[model samples]
Target: MTRVLLLGGTTEAGRMARALADAGVDAVYSYAGRTEAPVAQPLPVRVGGFGGVAGLVAYLRAEGISHVIDATHPFAAQMSRNAVEGCAAAGVALIALEREPWQAGEGDRWTHVPDLAGAVAALGEAPRWVFLAIGRQNLSAFAGAPQHHYLLRLVDPPTDPLPLPRAEAVIARGPFDVAGDRALLKDHRIEVIVAKNAGGAGAEAKLVAARELGLPVVLIDRPLVPERRVARTLGEVMAWLDG
Candidate 1:
């Protein structure tokens, strides 16, 4: 009876799901329901939240989930924290599949900020063309600095009007290449980039594109999550499950 729950939303989570299926592990993939169309996975999938720590604990107990793997995006602090608390209460083992944060490289001009608000503050008073690589959820925070024009790349087109007055949307998905991102920056005439330090190969193209074009990026650091066991690769997560 090795039922497991995989808290998922990142590219890494997709890979982990496939591995779990191939291994014939009984697991459920859970999405936060932020995206309109999430990628198909091999395991049974559940969308939306589990209410909170109490709800998550109830689910784990009722489903007999023996283990939990938190393969969510680094910036998804709230869900990650809830998972930690829920698993502890349910007496289930939990491990996080987390990627390392990106670091500044040669030829890159980066201003590091602790969080989203700091990123907004870093974008000084002067008006400029900015590539807002952070997702659509936190776009309203930028309204305070309405002087600059923003280029937003989203997984789905906005159903309602965007929060920013000077913002335009480009509907697309990631696993994006550097050439395409470079062309996007050129075409949009982006002078700076505002992005979260969501570390992974799939979404690193924008940083690479910024480096090649000599653009300054205001990088926002990942939020702190409760301490939990972490695995950096698919092999490691599989090993943990086996153990």
Candidate 2:
């Protein structure tokens, strides 16, 4: 009778879905529907939000969801907060699957900023060739630092032209390799990198390549979400469900 609702979007969420389905757990995956074509999940999937906290509570009750797992992107603080509130109201067990943040290693040139505004300010007034790898959603912040020339690597081509005065975008999917990333930086004549601290192997090669090229990175910190039970690994999440 342990039916579950999984708030999913990240790569880790896909892993958890496979594990849950293989274990024969009755669960449904909820997607925010941001991506045009998301990777298919192993579990039954629902697209879009649950309206908000009120709609989420109704869905949980109607579906008889006994547990809630927040496996959204690290920056998706709003969804995480809604899940915490909705699950608590429904009196269901809730757990968050959060990835560990990336740490600075030896030979790394990094400028750690608390938020997007901080990242923008770190770029300074003087023009520099920059790689903006933080995704399209937050690219607007760079409007504040127009002096820098930005090279954007994105999943899909932007319908509208970039907001920046001097910027270009390359459309491609990730699971990026260090060698390719190195060449990209070199080709772009990149002077610095601006990235969100989205710690995962799939999108981590840029950081590795930056270190190899001795490029300075402006890393935006993850936003704080509502406090809740959190599991760092898929095994830990499984244990929480069994507990």
Query: Each prediction's TM-score against the native?
Result: 0.99, 0.96
Q: Clashing pairs in model 1?
A: none
lDDT per residue (tens digit) for residues 30-74 in model 1: 999999999999999999999999999999999999999999999
Ten residues in a row with the worst lDDT in model 1?
Answer: 234-243
lDDT for each of the candidates?
Answer: 0.94, 0.91
Q: How many Å off is the CA of 12 in candidate 1?
A: 0.4
lDDT of 2 by residue, 1-243 (tens): 899888898889999999999999999999998777888999999999889999999999999999998989899988999989999999999999988899999999999999989988898888999999988888888898888899999877888878888889998787899999999999999999999998888889999999999999999999988889989999999998998
Q: Considering every candidate listed, which one attains the maximal TM-score?
A: 1
